[model samples]
Target: MSTSTSTAAADRTLVTALRERLQLDTGEAVSLVETHISWVLLTSRLAYKLKKPVYLGFVDFSTLAARKHFCEEEVRLNRRLAPSLYIGVVAVCGSAQAPHLGEGDPIEFAVCMRRFSEDALLQRLVPAGRLELDRLEQFAHRLASFHGRAQIAAPESEFATPDQVGRPVVDALARLRVDAGARPTRDLQTWIFEQRKALRTAWFARQRSGAVRECHGDLHLANVVLIDDQLTAFDCIEFDPALRWIDVMSDVAFLTMDLEAHGRRDLAFRFLDAYLQHSGDYAGMQVLRFYEVYRALVRALVGRFRVRAGAAQPGGPDYLACATRLARMPNSAPRLMLTHGLSGSGKSTMAAALLAVAGAIRIRSDVERKRLFGLEPHERSIDHPTNIYSREATERTFARLAECARTALQAGYPVIVDAAFLRRDERLLFRALAAQLHVPFSILRCRAGEADLRRRIVAREAQGRDPSEATLDVLERQLATQEPLDPGECAAVLDVATDAPVDVDALGARWLALSLPPITRRPAGWSAS
Candidate 1:
């Protein structure tokens, strides 16, 4: 037999022996799972992942020392996010006929970890229709918090440089050509070059501003799981620092692209909007589309690999189509929408619904107001006390909202200012912004009765989870002084009744018709409503 075949045979024998002889915490039989690069031994309570003695261009585990180093690296890096899941590195010793998990002279290494239910994976949850928006929103907050504190790449590092950012995308395209036996379409090629050229400055700015970090390079839904009802991210790319050290937006794009691929665009936008709210990284949205296309192509290549292994049928072509669709940009320019309503009238809720179908980014006043004061979204204004809602503070908040709205609009994304636009000047500020940017603008006029508004305010206060600190007193004051849209402003208003159940799909459709310019063409499977 050839050397490769002989080595594979030996590796298989060793895996079988280890599975039979290891005395795991669970007394049940051990099951073995194989992948292109590794083998995992699953016991009831634990998992032992061993790298295959093989060399792929992107990774090398052919030598025992190399495997040992990567095993340790995996445990260390994955522990950054899923500390409880990774249990540290262990040795595989003894002869292949009598292998031991942690004994004798070490022949190999395995990263030991706590086993999680496969069903809890987001990959499974998406297809099963078990994924909920609330859980996804919570996960968004968790991921944003993690990203905020993740280690930033040094300026001297080779990561997130313009060259490095484009390398993987170029490589993914080359691999797709080879694997699919086809070149990318002319449109995709043109888009790739144009987007790369456009984002060069943004990439440099982001790198200087510490947007590049040691991130979870492989952040697809399959790598995320629900542990104890918490969305936990694990299995980060540890074999290659070049891949792991990337722009934070690239990391966000991976999960968002995967969510879109799973036909959950609404959830994708919800998660993204939530992350932006927490991280205040609206500036990163500029490069998001480029990274999204790259991520989709990477996934398409991965799908091809799985298909070659007879693991999936539609895996490759399906993702290829997704990449093509993602590459297709809207011919029309982006729009700006403002929410006009009192607190408890569901302005935020309507904004979220609009984003789901409109493909927009939402910038909320309450969130930005707290952020300006160095407070988290749900944090009380007790520290700022008297000045948290002062007229000056409100002015600052509106200015911040306009700033974020401009950023989003400039990034080629629709913008929704999800604030209680209770004043004419407040409304005019956004209108002027849209006019200055030369984008379409409209208002979602949210309405709720006084009784319903009072009840909602009380309930939201009791929950203590909303960013708004609006009390019944605040509502009463707003009711007394809030300005209604005049005749000219009424031309651009889309009325929404907040007291009754909202047909979100219908509202989204109406809002799009009233706000954005008509799309000349949509990608296959792309929907506006």
Candidate 2:
């Protein structure tokens, strides 16, 4: 038979087999189009994915046995995020012409999954203005929750170390070197080395801190769908265990980078903020930028290779665009500016404004300390003299705040610490730590009139709304003992007055000017809206 005839025959066989496997009574059609590593068929209610019999450098499913194993692996890995979507693996039985779903001898394997609307994908939705920020926040929280419960492989496992996890990225860059010419390749190599060094420390720290876990290896927006008001992440990397077992932040960085690529950076910030609040794994922030850059470069290399290979596949252009975007991920680290003030000074409001510019993690010491004591934010404690506001309790509260700051900083996140900082020693400790870690830090000192503070305290007490639990007398006492920050202590200071419209934008602008280099600064009128 001719080559055309053989190809036509195989196509018909695949169509017939899909009908039998899916129990389709109607004359539903199927098209077996080959992808990079799999064959996908669009069916009425589901999509059947078959692993190709090919052995790539990083992935192998060349043999029938190997294919079946990976088919099962796909089901196992994807079920983590899309349990309801990934049905199971099905065996192709009998002869090619008259193949039955479960009859006769088994010949091939396929992963069966529920078909999702293509438009529901976050990537497509963002461009169409159909993606809601609140939904994205919920999705971020859900993904974080999933990672929290995911299993962490042992240190000896292939997925445990940065080198093992980054092998695919390293290999892709090497391949790109051949076609990118000398200069681009050299620049890419330098970036890769820096990324590897930073990520290695983060990876090991995560392992030691118990933040490494089995996660969705491929978390791009296209893999996520909004179905029935819930975000479903599917199409996980199934061929390699090393890819899937990773620090949770690495998995999140993929989605963050994808969101940024789609020109939805605001949504990206919202997503990261929600995820941090849900998981409380602030330490993961340290490695976020590195992983995002790595993921972007990997996409770029894949695009270059695809263009060279002349594979005009679906998402080819997207891969290239993604790569271009990835090359620019390491422009700068996020900035964090802390704010301290007395009651009615508008520190919380100022911190909230900064969130629009930088995805700032705002940690309120008042609320956290209340949580620690298992008390309501507005609940008053009986004056035990030694229990509620003792020197030891105050020290513990500062320690907790510092710990939270450290966690957020390590996770590659910027943070805003909101507190009174009435003690000079307490303020200096934070400043010293920030200097030691080499992260940019600042302070916004909010001040208002005495009458305003008194009125605000009274209003708060009446509304049963504040965690500070300060009475008029307590406020007066606090004023007497509050030690002013030394001129040399803070990087910047902002005056937040209740009577004036808080110039938060100006404050944020000043903060950007003080901390960020010219290259890292956002363009004029950048909204923290």
Candidate 3:
């Protein structure tokens, strides 16, 4: 028989088995695609993916045992993000004449997953103009929470280093270079090598700071689904633990790059902003661009290899085109905003609102001071004059806040320093730091009437819930000592009154519009990085 005849017969047999044995009543609609290591069947309510008998260097599902193990791995890993969607792995046995699911001896392994609406994917949503910054922010927070709870292996684990975690990428790139010859290969190789070097430092820092953990190794937009107003991340890499055990930022950068690739740079920025705000790991900025480029190259190289291996069908060049587009885009830095006001003037509320709207991290002086003292946020320390809200303690808190802001801004994230900058010296420190970092900085001042301030302080004391220990007496002292803003300080101020409803969103939008670089017009067929 001819090759075409054999292929048609095999596909027909599988389609017939799916209908008769798997109880998939697709009527006349049946499509099947055989990839390098899997056979994907698209059905009405679900997609059944079965492992193919192929041995790729890193992954081997050539044997029945190997296929079954990977099938189980798929189920286990996918359950982390899509517990309700990833049904289970079932055994397919018997002959094509009388195929059965989980019956008799097993001949094949299959993973059953719930089918989501095609339009629900981030890739589709962006083009439709349905993807919003708020939704992306929520997704970012969700991803951060997921990463926080993910299991972190010990430092001694074999998968702790960049070399171990990046081996697949390095190997894949090497093969692509060999196949594509010198020019394209050298450009890609240089890019990969530079990223790998930076990633090494990031990996070690994460290990030391406890950011190294088991994460979603393939966190791209296509893997994310919006079902019933909830975002779900699926198809995590389960074949290798080393690939998944990486810095949290690398995992985030994948999605960021994906958003950029889809022509949604604003959404990508919002996602990164939200994630950094929740995680408080500002050091991630230093390596985000490198990782984003690395991820894009990984996709590009894989797409290239698939075409070379005859695994990908014709029209596969489009996918490679998309990947190349992402690999070539320039990286943009994050914008920064600072908040200045007196205590009880609603700076915290304004800052929190700004965080929600702008997706910037809020570094509060009160909270950091308490954290430094090894005390709860609301705990009051009146042991000595130098212990609680004293000159030394205040200086240390400002320093820490500046450091945190610098780290966050460096990571390509805007930051809001929520502090009562009633003194010129205190405000000068932040301005100088922002100047050194070369990030745009602004101050949001919350001004309220004296009577309103007194009432707020009284209410805070009555509630016993605020982190601030300011009382009526303390408030009076603060007012007396509060210095007028200097010309430099006056330059960055955005006066916000507390008596009326503050349009915080409008304020934040204005700040971001002024501070951030104008969104460059992406060239035709341009992709994100």
Candidate 4:
């Protein structure tokens, strides 16, 4: 037999031996789960994953030593995120006929892990409508924080190079050409070529600026589970550093694409906005669509492989449709909207609610102001309290917000500035920016009764959970100096009664209707491939 066939046969023999004789607390027969790259034997509480001795070009676990090294690597790397899930690397010893685990000279190796309930996976939760927005927001916060602290790729490394980034796309496209229709594959390749050129400078700049990092290579919903009501990410790509060390936005796009594939575009946008809010990576949005399409194609290729292996999968066509949909520009043109409100008038809340429907990014003055002083969203600025809220600091904060809004708008994304645009000049600054960019501009005038605003601010302060550091004193200052909209400005305003229930969807639709359509560069008659 050929070497690969022989290796496969040996791996099967070892797996079969382990399944029959492995001991567990449940006293039940050990069940096996097989993927293209590994074999996992499951007990009641633990899972032992053994790598298949196969070389897939991108990854190689074809030798005993390679498998052992990768097994240890898996444990080491995964512990960075989910330490409790990965117990350790354990040895599988003896011949295939009488395999032993963790007890003899190592003939094989397995990464032992604590098994979680399959039902708690985001994959199932999404379909069952059990996934809550709060949980997703928390996950976004954790992931953004993780990405911020992840190891930056070495300057000398090939990771995130233009060639390296495009290699996987080319490989997946080649496979898809054979499995999918020739015409669509060709069109997709053409679109990718154009997009790559458009985003070339951005890719290199991001790489140099440390946007590339060692990330969870496999961040799909399937690899994420809810343990003790926390979103836990596991099963990262340990076999290939090239895959694991990538642009952080590439990692973000995987879960974003998966969410869209599962028909939750609203949640996908919500997740992306939350991630952006935490990471302050607005520039990443420029290349986000490219990565989203690339991720979809990769998943499509995997689904095709799974179908060939006789496994039930979402099937390649579903992902292909998603990619095609993503490649098309947004239905409406990108516009800029400023939330006009005082402290506790619900500008932040209103901005968040309108994000999904408007397909926009929301930048908050409170968060960015704290960020300027190297503080987290909810962190106190006790050390520099006066400086943080000074008139000069306020000017800097509004300037920063304006810059962020410009970046998102230029990247063909609508933007909502969640700030107290109580000054006519502050509002005019963003309006001029929108005019300069030739995108539409409008205002969301959020209002609440004075008593209600004071009550809400007091309650928020007592809770100490919100990002705003605005106190009653701050509210009084805002009320004293706030500028009401002039007649001309009022003409462009979408009044939002914050104390009452607002139909964000209806409001978003009306706002978008007034904006100019986005400049889609394609010919007028062209259709989405």
Off by over 4 Å in 3: 1-16, 23-34, 165-199, 302-337, 342-399, 409-420, 423-425, 435-482, 491-529
lDDT of each: 0.86, 0.70, 0.71, 0.85
Tens-place lDDT digits, model 1, residues 1-529: 9999988899999998899886554567888888899999998888999999988888999899999999999998999889999999999999887788776899889999999889999999988899878889898998888889999999888898888888788888888898755467878878887888888899999999999999899999989999977888999998989899999999999999888888888788999999999999999988998888899988888777776788874532366666777788742357888999988999998898879887789999999999998999999997775687889999999989988888888988878999889898888877777766767788898999988899999999999999999999999899899998877568778889998888888877766665433532222333222
Count clashing pairs, candidate 4: 1
Residue 128 shift from truth in candidate 2, angstroms: 2.4
In the order shown, the candidates' Cα RMSDs to the true structure are 5.1, 7.3, 8.5, 4.9
Which pairs clash (backbone N, Cα, C closer than 3 Å) in model 2? 282-407, 283-411, 284-411, 285-411, 285-412, 286-410, 286-411, 286-412, 300-323
Which residues of candidate 1, in runs, are more than 4 Å off? 1-5, 23-27, 313-317, 330-333, 515-529
Write down the TM-score of every candidate. Answer: 0.94, 0.75, 0.72, 0.94
At residue 222, give the lDDT of candidate 1.
88
Q: Write the per-residue lDDT of candidate 2 for residues 1-529, one digit (tens) a residue.
A: 9966775567457656665654554466655556678777777687878776667877997678999998998898888788899899988777666665565567778788888778898778888898877788778878977987888777666565777656766766665666643124455566667777766876777787767788888898778998878878888988777778788888999988877766666577668766765666666766776677667766666556666677644543354344444554433354555677776666766675666455567677776666566654446766433475778887887788788887776555567887878777777667655665567767877778888878888987888745667688877777888887766544346555655776665666666556533333332233222
Pairs in clash, predicted candidate 1: none
Name the weakest run of 10 consecutive residues (lDDT summed) in model 2: 520-529
Residue 484 local lDDT, model 1: 86
- With a 3 Å backbone cut-off (N, CA, C), the pairs that clash in candidate 3 are 285-411
| Residue range 14-70, candidate 3, lDDT tens digits | 546865544544455645666666777766787788876656676777577987898
Model 4, 319-362: lDDT tens digits are 87788778877656789899988898998888888988877889
